[model samples]
Target: MSGPVTLPAILARRAAATPHAEALVIDGVRVDYRTLHERVQSAAARMVAAGVQHGEHVGVLMGNSVDWVVLFYAAASIGAVTVPVNTRFKLDELNYCLKQGDVRVLFYVDTFLNIDYTQLLRDVEPAFDAALPGEVLPLLRRAVIVGDVAGHDARAIPAGVERFDALPDTPEWRAEAAARAQRVSPEDILLIQYTSGTTSFPKGVLLRHRNMLMNAAASALRIGVQPDDRYFSVRPFFHVAGTTMSLLVALVTGACLLSVPSFDVANVLTMLDEERCTLTSGNDTIFLMMMGHPEFRRERIHLRGGWAAAGPEIMQKIHDVMGVKYMVGAYGQSEASPNVVLNDWRDPLELRVAGWAAPHPGLEIRTVSQETGEVQPANAPGEIQVRGWSVMKGYYNKPQETAKAFSDDGWLRTGDLGVIDADGRMRMLGRLKDVFRVGGENVAPAEVEETLFSHPAVQLAQVVGVPDARLGEVAAAFVVLRPGTQASSEELIAWCKSRCANFKVPRYLQLVLSFDEIGMTGSSKVQKNKLRDYAIREFGLA
Candidate 1:
């Protein structure tokens, strides 16, 4: 914590302190810190040798693997900004990320049916074969393939395409890259994480090393993660919550990080038991999956603590069943380096209250009425606003959108509607955009959604406003049932009525196989806009 506290520095410090300890676990591959550090240094050297410079953007289009983590740390070591392109994204999404971040180099895994990087590059660069040798690619320069490259011919290599194996490990190169990395300031831009907005385009959330480190430090402190604690990370590294709060926090705190390529409930359960993982974090879906898992008996997993962001009932259920010693319920967004408010472990009631703002020294939180813009007193629901060190620099390249998120005084308008209680805890009511008028009575969908999740048959639920001539707007519930379990619409409606205010109950319930096709951002929050559109289209409310 002494010098310029960059990510590379943290990795280096951890490597120095515990070189032989396991740094990453993926696909049965265990990489010790010594090996992980060396791999990062070697990759950084290759990147520099390939002409990547400080402040330049390096696009990483790979799945959750050691290669992805290596490239991320490699870029950070050289002061190059890492842009983690979602592997699930199609060609259009990949192209947008490349253009939006102005990515100069791309490190990608070989093309799969789910994502065709070769086809995407072809679309981005039409004249690939005729380009001059050593010519810099404006859209994307170097295309380094992660796995085997035997089938890909020279013609398909484009101008500057390189294989990951071609990058050799050399001491001189490692020293030079490490020396360069040492100069990186905490204020330097570390990552650009894309989050989907109400529009079709995803916004690039810009986060600096300082912002991320501060947030991680705060989260680590909040969770009380000790050096001996082993934290499991099933959340993808591309997400702000997973990368900074989970992975980086482990690195900075001298803790072990056991990462999985994806969330397989059974695999996660096994790992929690096998690794003795003390901490974990995920959204409601993950918690529900764990609770519903056939083998999820309390005695099987030895979890000391973890964090969750879900409804109050789900939180209570997790507490009751999981035997998690310290579970924090958090709320935040990618724009604020993800964690703005979190329920403290000190009080179980804090989980029931609105999330408290992060222990960000300079951060401020306020509530203002949506209709009047008047500041609301304690317990009165209003729009939540925040200004803090943890806030992102801005949405990358979208000056207009960035401006819209802030007020004249520079407080970030969170777009979430909530109330600050007299005790200084802020309770989130729902998203301002998610609230609807039902027969002139304001209805918050989150209220209904949470109540529905508490239903024994409902595994996951989302509520949206569907147009009704009689009521102006009526609540519609889209539910995903517990595996092999089914509940009728009437039962669900009655369940909601029993738990919540009558006005909050859904008038119509749609038993769906899934919520929406829209994928999760690196963080596991539901893409509500996708759900809203699905409700409009499928229910004929549009």
Candidate 2:
């Protein structure tokens, strides 16, 4: 029970400890630990009956739901790698992901938000024969659909697709799945999570069961996760942040997840209060919406601790506006099981907010000069490199990219720039590739964006570098105002000029209506490359 923490082992331990505990509660559906365990077992058996072999890749393209959780754990238990695809992906994006991952079977909801997936699949590949591997997705042999597909409004499932509701969960299949689960190893590759690529194409990060489980256990303990804690699950399952930190952490700690499919401030606040959630995690945009909600003060929210990774300005505002005082700030990316620096739950609010994060146990962190490969002094920003038990195996099948990812001594160069403070806490500065030089001075967009957030008129601020004839590059600001609030480009420009250095001030400003206009990934990271293109076109800066 103590060594080699595997997914099946975690599931078994939790179910035995608290079989009747609430494991998942979402949209009028509640499932206890025992029920969840049984569902996962049945799903694993059904997958085997459908010809899913051990170590095969299974893709899940669905919104947040009980079934999505079941598929994830079931695949892990049976030694199959689960690829979490963004449900928001269009046909082309979906095809690219499925093909690149070499997914053998895909499970997707038939319809979500007015889009008919079955039709989309047929449209993408006109000759998609379900009985054989898909023409577009050459490895896909099975398409499992989960939705209301049997009633009057239901459409006929394409050939080779099976409705999950109609699949049999026989005792024989369950026994077979159990036998398969017994053979699953802790070191087996179980996840192929794609990084939300902002500047370049997404790469599949290969992760094993130990990478995920150990990170989950260590991170959960760092945040003081309790068995009865109600974690407000807002992050999507496709991202490591959602799975490693929220869902898997729940299984490790016996916590219950109050799932949120999308970010709706009113609904989130209502659910948080109704479910009596003790913890919630999100970035600044999410917490800002929560604080700006009309019912925030009235709800008298009951909470203890959660993860919030906005910079200093937004973190302070969250504490002031939302009374979210017991939150932790951390840093990481998908390749490191999504956790490198985690805040100790016992730290004071000031220490937690000011210091980005202290290193989690079993991980080594250092900021090394990019040019010399020498370690930087304290408070000097450099590329943050990590070596730890939780680091991923490698990028799936891309040997050259994988070779470039790690050093000869085995440390994974994170590509993120950071500074270790005098107190040994790490503060993320920005990405090394994201820095823009303004008149020979290095300008980190995050610094400018953080400054913009301090302005009362700005709700969300994203700064991107734009081409300038003389300066080589100048900063451009995209501002999203708070609800019912308005601001002018000239006004924000003047505000920046007053607060920031002349070179650091953004040269151009544009007001954006929504994040879609900014081209955000499903994980909520801003697509800066898209913003740069928009800035260039809008300003005629060619």
Candidate 3:
């Protein structure tokens, strides 16, 4: 039987198709499809009582949990667009997304992984303590806490904020929610994914029900997902890898999703063995950490297959050490609902390890020269471009960036160097854009440079990606201090750690005399390639 395309319809159909089947497993809680659907319905009704309207942005700032899942589905059921916040975001980053996303309602946890969100929200807007939405976040009217704040009584909760459990649930509101779900169309905007581009600020990529649902189905097809399968995914729920690739894949296929609140190598290994997980997925960093751990035993692992975004060496290691014999390669960005191309598990090991994959049905992939906009022949490297049903509508509220994202003919410019073989299998060469990935997280050099520039003693800063054994790449910095000012490399690195996410922090820092000493063009633009080469040799990273 064909499944539904929209999120709300998918949950309902899954509940009817497999009411008693285990749909989710998180934090030691096992929820079946029927129970999951019922929880979503209650949450949707509460949203209606809170005065949330259709198409309004609902921000969810929490780690992976049953509450997060329910809130996402609930928002979709009532036609509200979910704006998932990155748990790694600090105060400033969090505030930026809240304002840029135009969030009217926010559902968050008091704390997760020792990060005090209650304090973070208070820092975002001081009026949060008084329960009154402030001018800082004018669009935000309602705040809902999903769980209790540690060491705090119920009365201590903020005045304007409401507890998720306390949200009103009535028959009338539930009926209205269901009616709203029926009106949801596949073309309706489902979520606005904020991802780091080749700029200092992150841009929101608008995705529709058809874009994400179809991508999830395609990933499920490639992995040969089955109802009896247990899918373990450590990918954070805030990322498209979690939503479209893991969560929706499970929902569409009736697979039980073994969710992780936070990634712990020891805990993950224990869960894989105890849960008898049949499938799991992650980048090289995750797989390498698990295998490198002393607790990892190949005999105890039951994972048969899953997709990975890694090079050939790591793919081989995952197969040899981790025993994921059918592991396949993947390629995508947030703008394409995150899964433009993925290899089939049934393919040969050599093909699967090649880092090339077949594009999803109805998607087109080609390469064009960087210097000229002319298309390249098969097997020749060029800038990878795509166009199809999966491409995002556009970046929210950024018309110029959105226009630059596409070509004159409408192909979405991927900004990655790649090649398409005669067989139509696409393989990535390297990034044409400066944006680099650190353990599956995209890090824009401009974002890090901006953070470094905030330091008082720093006059100039340039960031680059350097090779690492554990993480695929880590940030390295070259700094030119202010006149007569002195700052140690450790001090500058520590300054960044306090200001930005861990992945964005520079692991290595070098004090340089000037940009001219490194390399500069006629326009005085710092040549990043030359700096990266210098860092590689100086740090012995090559």
RMSD list, candidates in order: 2.6, 1.8, 10.6
- On TM-score, the leading prediction is 2
Tens-digit lDDT track of model 3 for 204-297: 9999998999999889999989999999998888888889999999998999999888778899999999999999988655675677667989
Q: Quote each prediction's TM-score.
A: 0.93, 0.96, 0.82
How many backbone clashes are present in model 1?
Answer: 2
- Against the reference, the lDDT scores of all candidates come to 0.78, 0.84, 0.86
Q: What's the CA error at residue 173 for candidate 2, in Å?
A: 1.9
What are the clash counts of all predictions, listed in order? Answer: 2, 0, 1
Candidates 1 and 3 compared: the better one by TM-score is 1
Expressed as tens digits, the lDDT of each residue in 327-416 for candidate 2 is: 888788999998899888788878777746888877989899977989889888889999989899999888999999998888999988
Better of 2 and 3 by lDDT: 3
Deviating ranges (above 4 Å) for candidate 3: 1-4, 196-199, 434-542
Q: Which window of 10 residues has the lowest lDDT sum in candidate 1?
A: 128-137
